[model samples]
Target: MTKTVVMILFIAACVALGALSGAGNQPGEWYQSLNKPFFNPPSWIFAPVWTFLYILIGVALSATWYDENNGRRLVLFAIQAALNLLWSPVFFGLQSPALGLVVIIPLLVSILMFIAASWRENRAAAWLFLPYALWVAFATLLNLSIVLLN
Candidate 1:
């Protein structure tokens, strides 16, 4: 397959997997009852924001896909992706914001590590992860706040 085709597939897969992960682990009454911070965004904001971020993440992954020396980068990407998918289950499915904090902190670190690893080799990939890093950082703070508030 062509590089463009592979990239498109990667993007689609990221979005699809993310959507699937979220679909089954929605924040129900338990989440609604929790005391959220003042800055918690409306529920409507999450879908679009996550979709955009996933596309960026997919692009970053595609950028590094063909790298000959991508072992470390790939590991970082996988670690972050796994942690990202794991958060919803821990936070919403299990209704444990404290456990979510545990997952998200490492997730944020893995994202930063991915960005740093990509910096010298593929600046585009690193730049792509910047938003993901920022969003996850915000999410980490949000998770921490939720844990503290409740």
Candidate 2:
């Protein structure tokens, strides 16, 4: 019962924190300014997709909690999450697609590193991150296209 509660809270907090990175700012304004790539998903798709991704991230984070008190992995996950949050404000709020592209590169690397680290400690948890890594990869490409086109 306690573990379930903990997982719920952990998922909620992580998703909230991630949401903070992209919360403010009117969508469609700056976003429409960008020359989105052909492959870019509709703007309406972001909210639902990110909501799902956050749930996955929550699960991934919870998986780490099972591996003893490994503060290092927690810190790594936090670092990546913070970067994930920052990308939105940089890209949309500030209207800096180039800067957003730069930001996501490190975020991508951090997530990859997190997956690598988790692989050593928990393979299942690392596997959960695979979708996230793939999404970031697509995001990176989309950002690059936006930067180049706009």
Candidate 3:
């Protein structure tokens, strides 16, 4: 397959997997009853934001995939992806914001690590993760808030 095709596949797979992870682990009454911070965004915003971020993440992954020297980058990508997928289940499915904090803190670190690892080799890939990093930072704060409030 062509590189373009492979990149597209990566993006599609990322978006699909992210959607699937979120679909089964939605916030029900338990989440609604929790005391949220005033800065909490409306529920509708998460899907679109995550979709956009996943697209960036997929592109970053694809960008690094072809590079033989990117083993560390790939590993960081996988770690962050796994952590990302685990967050919803811990936070919403199990209704444990404290556990979610445990997952997200490292997730944010891995994302930053990925950006740092990719910076010299593939600047675009690192740049792509900038928003993801910022978002995760915000999410970490939000998760911490939820944990403290309740």
Candidate 4:
């Protein structure tokens, strides 16, 4: 099994799990209610953006998983993924942006560590997470806004 193949599997797992965790958040009800920041892209933008991001994450992890798959970076990759899953349900389903924001802090930190660690293992792979990191930063701001507005 090639490392790329393994990482692809892992990335696919993240997206599949993420979508499942978000199953309860109906777009009609949940998304329509939120007070999005002015900077928020059209609601339609999320799927594609995350889709691309998931691919990148997969490449990144697969690269790391390719290298050794037995390091702290690999573990952090998993941790960040778990954190990613929690954000959607917390914010959209429970309608608790505050708690979601709280949860995301650790997620954000985990991602940073993932990037740094992945960089040490594979610079290209680390770069793969850059968009995800940026998106999360944007989301943190957006989440803060939603909490404040609603």
Candidate 5:
């Protein structure tokens, strides 16, 4: 029971960190004024999608943390998390799609590295990160499109 609770809290912390990052860097008027691709999702879509993704990330992290031989994997997780934390600020806060691209490319790579590393520790962890990887890949494309358009 205690272990379960610890897991839950750990996961919650990861989710919370992502949420906090988003909250701190809101898509304000600066974001709204920018020209986006036609395929850009409605503003309403991001919250729920990120919420779900963060949960998956949290679970993946917990699984990786508990796995044996997870030292390198955990480092990957931390690197990815740092990259994740930087995206909103660079993209939204700084209001630079070009810079967003800079940050997200690395963020995407870190996520891939984390996913690949996770596979060595836990398959489920790797699986859990797939959606995140996909999302970031799509986001990278979106960012690229924006940089080109605007």
Candidate 6:
């Protein structure tokens, strides 16, 4: 397949997975009842922020996928993405902030590893992941706060 085709596929894959996860785990009454932290962002912010991040991550992964040395980085990216997908189900579907924290911590670490591995092969790819890392870091804290408060 052509590089462009592969890139588009990656983008589609990320968006599809995100949409499916979001659909499966809608934040309804269970989430509304939880005691959120003072710093918790308004619910409206999540969609836009997540949309942007997922796009960045999709591009980053596409860039890294073409690199010959991307095996480990791609593996890390897949692991992190799987963990990312898992978080919504565990936290929202199952209604367990504590489990979310458990999943997110490793997700953050895998993201860091992915960034570090991608840096050597493609700096742009690594740079694309910075915001994702920061967001997950913030999310980890948010998940922690939720667990603590509730």
Cα RMSD (angstroms) for every candidate in the order listed:
0.5, 1.6, 0.6, 1.9, 1.3, 0.9
lDDT of residue 8 for candidate 3: 97
* Residue 64's lDDT in candidate 4: 73
Candidate 3, residue 56: how far the Cα is off, in Å: 0.5
Candidate 6 to truth, TM: 0.96
Q: Is candidate 4 or candidate 5 better by lDDT?
A: 5
Which portions of model 5 show Cα errors greater than 4 Å?
Answer: none
* Model 2 ranges off by over 4 Å: none
Question: How far does residue 77 in candidate 2 sit from its true spot (Å)?
Answer: 0.3
lDDT of 5 by residue, 1-150 (tens): 566776788779977988899999999998888888999999898888998998888888777767888999888888888888998999998888999899999989988988887776688999999999999999999999999988
TM-score of each: 0.99, 0.91, 0.99, 0.88, 0.95, 0.96
At residue 123, candidate 2 shows an lDDT of 88
Residue lDDT tens for model 6, 1-150 = 998888888888888889899889988999999998999999898988888888888999889988886788888998999999999999999998998899999999999999888877899999999999999999999999989999
Instruction: Tell me the tens digit of each residue's lDDT in model 4 across 1-150.
Output: 765568768889767776677565645676677777788788778888888888888777767775765488878988898889878878777778899999888888899888887776688978988899999988888888888888
Give one clash count per candidate, in the order shown.
Answer: 0, 0, 0, 1, 0, 0
Q: Per-residue alpha-carbon lDDT of model 3 for 1-150, expressed as tens digits?
A: 988999999999999999999998999999999999999999999999999999998999889999879989999999999999999999999999999999999999999999999999999999999999999999999999999999
The per-model lDDT (C-alpha) reads 0.95, 0.84, 0.96, 0.80, 0.88, 0.91
User: What ranges in model 3 sit over 4 Å off?
Assistant: none
Tell me the spans in candidate 6 whose CA falls farther than 4 Å from its real position.
none
Give the C-alpha miss distance for residue 29 in model 6, angstroms: 1.0
Give the Cα-based TM-score of candidate 2 against the true structure: 0.91
Q: Give the range where candidate 2 is weakest over 10 consecutive residues by summed lDDT.
A: 21-30
